[model samples]
Target: MTPMIEIDEVTKYFGTKLVLDRVSLTVNRHEVVCLIGASGSGKSTLLRCVNRLVAHDYGTIRLDGVPVDDPRFGKTGLQKRAGIVFQSYNLFPHMTVLENITLAPRRVHGVSRAEATARAQEVLARFGMDGFAQAYPEQLSGGQQQRVAIARALMTKPDVLLLDEITAALDPELVGEVLAIIRGLKDAGMTMMIVTHEMGFARDCADRVAFLSDGMILEEGPPDRIFGAPEQPRTRAFLDRIIASGRL
Candidate 1:
């Protein structure tokens, strides 16, 4: 598979506090790579840096072999190519589901409302959300809202998708439904880089799994290797803790 996203010796700092320390990784086209670690391990920060939501302090991030900071891909251009969905669902409470999904294309990409609405309806129906186009965020369940968020991200037809703990805020029963959507995306050949605490989902769905410690990748391999026989002591310890907590 061709490399879709690449990070080489990337570093990030938050007010002098080092968040990422020369981290490097690669995500291939039509692949799902999961970043797994405890909170504050820089998984989320790394995902943000990919789309320039949080600029890296050093090193480089390239999308499809082009530097992310290249002037050709202006801020909106980069975002349009790399759609992101966060844990909070980030929907506009004031807007209906259709409105929220169509906002970016209509406003930022110069898509007409009629065209955007038609596209939104098609995507929503694909996600089984066609019935809720007129509903507000608060009117939907957590799972439904999250599905809407994913649908909204898909509106831009991104080249790669970044998911940051997308199931972290859901109820246990609702988690599966959201994860199911990701599984569907994977089946349809959507390239995704995911930051997640859901170890089982990562193990089952990801083509590769990367374990991050502090701000660096400690061990990375197929799920069978990482979950079944991690070579690094730190990775073993982290998995042990997750197992003890009954989270893995």
Candidate 2:
């Protein structure tokens, strides 16, 4: 079976400073991969490269074995192949929940308003946010807004979903609800790449876990191996500091 996403010898540089050093990985369909590391580890950069949000300076990225970084990717067709959800819920505050979810589908995909609404309603129901369809972003809580953001991304019916710290800004009490929604997506076989600090959720939801350090992948393995018995000194040290600091 073809992998959903593949990165090979990928390197990204900002000025003379290199951020990603020949990093490579593969994510299969229905699989969840978690990227864990300190800030400036290139985890976010790698995510951006997957969708051409930040074009790489070197190396190749293939989506379902089709080279995506090539200019042909856009000329041929790959723009609607993936979806992204950010740390901050980037919602249109002026639009109602349904409107926000329906905008892209209607405009970009040429999905009729009525058809988009139907899909939005189904997605919102799946996200447990159907009750808020008529509500505005400001009227909803942070967790609720993030769920709306997820639903909006799902509105595109993407093959791969990129989540960057989607739960980071939420109140502690509200984290569980968002994580629960993600768990539901995983249970339903959504292919995902998650950059998160929520260790327990990553361990529970990730098929594989990767430890990124500096600009390189210091360790990677099944969750049991990465979390239970990390092979690298950097991995163990990182985990130690997080645990000792009571941040894990």
Candidate 3:
């Protein structure tokens, strides 16, 4: 079967610095792949390239077998196919939760207001944000706003979801709520590529775990192998740090 996401020797740079260096990986349908790496390891950059948030400098990224940079693919089409959520809740502060969730569906997807609203309500209820329809971004907790962002992404019925350090901005007590929602997504067989620093969460939730260092995937395997006995010395050192920090 064709993979849902494929990256082939992809490389990216920001001015003089290389962010992703000849990286390649695949995520099959209904698979949850977690990227576990220290800061500046190109985790978020890879996801952005997948979703076409930033164009890759070399190599190719394909989604559902189509090149992401192909002219026919189009930005809106790519955005619709791969919904993304970030660490900072990117909700429009002036909009209510319902409006925020429904805006893209109604505008970009050409969904009617009533239809968009119904979809929003259903996904919000699914994510345990049922009563937050009228709340503004500032009024909700960080976790709730993040949930709203995820729900909004789901509203578009994306083929793949990209999450970039989504819990990085949340309070310790609030992290579980958002992670619980992600676990629920995994249970529902959503195809996902997540960048996260939470090792325990990565171990418990990822179908496969990849450890990246210096813009390359140093090692990737089943969670047990990658976490219990990382082969690469670099991976071992990183996990040792994670253990020292009491995260693993």
Candidate 4:
């Protein structure tokens, strides 16, 4: 079967500084793949590349084996296939939760307002934000805003979801609520590529965990092996640091 997303020898550089060096990975349908590494390890950059939020300097990225940058795909088409939620909630401050969630579908996809609203209501209800549809961003906590952001992404009914440090901005107490929604998505078989610093969460949620070091994926395997018995020295060193920080 064709992979849902494929990255082949993708290289990216920020001026003289190289951020990604011949990196490659594949994400299959209904599979949850987690990218685990320290900050500046290029995990987040890889996620951005997959969603076309940023472009790679070399190599090709494919969605279901079709080139991601193909002119025919267009920007809107690429976004529709892959939905991404960032660490910071990017909702418009003036828009209510319902309006925020329905904006893309109504404007980009050309769905009628009534239909977009119904779809928003359905996803918001599913994600336990039904009561807050009319609430403004200021009225909700960080966790609630992040949840709304995730709901808005799902409104597009994307084929793949990319989550980048989604719980990073939340207070410790608020983290679980956001994580629970993600857990629910995994249970529902949402094909996802997640870049996260939470080792325990990565172990629990990932079908496969990839250890990236110095802009390359040094090792990848089932979470059990990657966590319990990493083969590469770099992978083990990274995990050692996580354990030392009491984050594992």
Best by lDDT: 1
For model 2 the local lDDT of residue 243 reads 82
Clashing pairs in 4: none
| TM-score, every prediction | 0.99, 0.96, 0.98, 0.98
Please give, for residues 1-87, the per-residue lDDT of candidate 2 as tens digits: 459999998999999999999999999999999999988899999998899888898889999888886666563246567888998
Clashes of 3: 0
Model 3: pairs clashing at backbone N, Cα or C within 3 Å: none
RMSD of each: 0.6, 1.5, 0.9, 1.0
In TM-score terms, candidate 3 sits at: 0.98
Q: Taking the tens digit of each residue's C-alpha lDDT, what string does model 1 give over 32-110?
A: 9999988999999999999999999999999999999999997599999999999999999999999999999998999
**Local accuracy of candidate 3 as per-residue lDDT tens digits, 138-227:** 999899999999998888899999999999999999999999999999999999999999888999999999999999999899999999
- Misplaced by over 4 Å in model 2 are 70-79
What are the lDDT scores of the predictions, listed in order? 0.96, 0.89, 0.93, 0.92
State the weakest 10-residue window (summed lDDT) of model 4: 66-75
Q: Please list the residue runs of candidate 3 whose C-alpha ends up more than 4 Å from where it truly belongs after superposition.
A: none
Candidate ranking (lDDT, best to worst): 1, 3, 4, 2
10 residues in a row with least lDDT, candidate 1: 69-78
Question: Which digits, one per residue and each the tens of the lDDT, describe model 4 over residues 148-235?
Answer: 9999999989999999999999999999999899999999989999999888999998999999988999999999999999999989
Off by over 4 Å in 1: none
